[model samples]
Target: MRTADFHIEDARGDATVLKLTGDWTTMGLNQAAIRLGESLRGYSIEQVDLSELGRFDTAGALALVQASNFAMPANAFDTRPEAGRIYAMVETLERQSAEPPKRQAPLVRIFSKIGHGVHDAAAEILLSMAFLGRLMGATGFAFRHPGAIRWPAWVSQAERSGLDALPIIAVTNFFIGAVIAFLGADLLTQFGAGVFTVQLVAVAVLRELGVLITAILLAGRSSSSFAAEIGSMRMSQEVDAMQVMGVNPFQALVIPRLAAMVVMVPLLTFVGMVSGFLGGMLVVWSQLDYGPAFFIQRVSEDPDMGTHLMVGLVKAPVFAVVIAAIGCRQGMAVAGDVESLGRRVTAAVVQAIFAIIALDAVFALIFLELNL
Candidate 1:
């Protein structure tokens, strides 16, 4: 059969008529609709003669209805029952599209956003405190029953979070130390006290940068890994299985990680300190032509070495607790989806880093007050 087509009868006046002929099927309806719409655009369509249309499907009906701008009256077209029903459906859809959407006031929207953020922050803080409490309880229980401690898991985590991370940590601290030495030497040279560069590197690396860099690296490495691993377990229902089998997820999953961080972070901090010192030594020897023996002599003579080293190491355990807790807490918060796992892992790393920096600032204030 011939494809459906339409032609304008008289489109110049206020009342226009469209005469459709042949088979009005899907094959030709789209083009037919375009042509019909163009012809009817200049005038108000008053009549549609579909009596000559041989056969039409729902597709054709929709095309004609849309081309008429959903304003075609019921009596305007002599359409088959199927086409009439299709026309009615399109009309309903058009009415829905034309509806004006409801909008909120700008102030209301701003306040709603602020309220949601505050609520989310409060909820996150509460959840973190609850997780911290659980971890402390687990640690106490392990201490009471030494046999319950997962030594193998703890050892394994230590290797991953400590030994394996040494290279990058060393490289990072080394470069930072070198940069500090260079800056210090350049500034102090003007005052003819270039030797004080050793003092600057020693104080900064031993007291702050070493431990801070180590914690930040671990926050990125171990925290993200912990979140992803635990989230995967949750996704696979392994955590649920552990619960069903009477295994405490906290003891099995969280405790070993917490213990590993507590023990290894201090060791990593020490490594960072040594690496940074070596870096400073290299910079001093190469750039300032200072001897290693002289640099060591100056560093050892500094009264703040003992105090700064002690203060820096002291922060390691606390930083470890925050990093591990944030990681595992975010992991436990994961929902049952890959997207949720990814989001939780990202949030875990970000939160861990922020917490470490904030806690470091707090520690700095405490030490300053203590005059250490």
Candidate 2:
């Protein structure tokens, strides 16, 4: 039919004429199928005639076929040429709709995904172990990739992570130290041990707080930045581009970041130590008339100086690893979406900070038990 106005008289006992006049394509067929199905409902209509259907397409033919199937199984269906065309159209429409949608899965899909993840992770670990074994066999290769040093990478990283960070790290730590001195002064004054503020600032800054604070700050500044930068590169397909050009993304991106963090954290720790000491010196000299020399003397007098310095320095690389690992892992995990990249980078920063704090606490407890 040229128009949807064509219909059967007294059909379904409703005394309505089914009209059909449209494009008669997939979209049209869908509309016809829905309307026909609705009209058939709660009605005794057993068949339809479409002999006046002057034109029909594959979609119209399919819809007509489906109508016949539905009517036949439930009731006796009379077929006319025009009616047959309409029935065929509906049949095709139903078939097309019945096909599943892509990327649509069941409700428990996440569990299936998790199971696959566990399997993949296990397989990856096993493969890595096997590769390590092969490396062991290749003594020359292992020698070339020695665990002890990667001097060129280290120097490059030190320039980027440490040298570049110096000014900000120094300024921040100085303020932090000043704040601690002010607080320590007030607290110690109440105990008639005001002079001991020097010891409090010295030991706390060097032994724990200074390194931990510096690490946490860097984790925020550096780790999150690394994740975002790499994630953007990943989204733009630059990482894949590099791979296509025969460049190692890990060596080019990850190694540099990891090396930089490792080199910078120690130097930052040193900066923090100096600034914190200076901060405390300011408060002691200005408020208490203790003088810079007096505060320095108190630090020098501490017999545990070497132990405290060693503990702080040793924590640096651990902090660096946490920062770099979180950044790279999250960056590499990024999917194609901008939202996913932002979320992962934020998570990386938070995870890195938590890891740094957790590791610092563990090391502190361990060292305390060992009397370090």
In order, candidate lDDTs are 0.89, 0.73
How would you encode candidate 1's per-residue C-alpha lDDT over 1-372 as one tens digit per residue? Answer: 777787777655655777789888877564777787777786566787777887777677677777777777677544567667766776777667766767889999999999999999999889888988888898899999989988899899999888999999999999989999999998999999999999999999999999999999999999999999999999999999999999999999999999999999999999999999999999999989999999999989888899999999999999999889889999998989999999999999999999999999999999999999
Error of 1 at 47 (Å): 2.4
Superposed by TM-score, candidate 2 places the C-alpha of residue 367 at a distance from the truth, in angstroms, of 0.8
Q: How many backbone clashes does candidate 2 have?
A: 37
Q: Using TM-score as the measure, which candidate wins? A: 1
State the local distance difference test value for candidate 2: 0.73
- What 10-residue stretch in candidate 1 is worst by lDDT? 73-82
Off by over 4 Å in 1: 1-15, 20-44, 51-69, 75-79, 90-100, 103-107
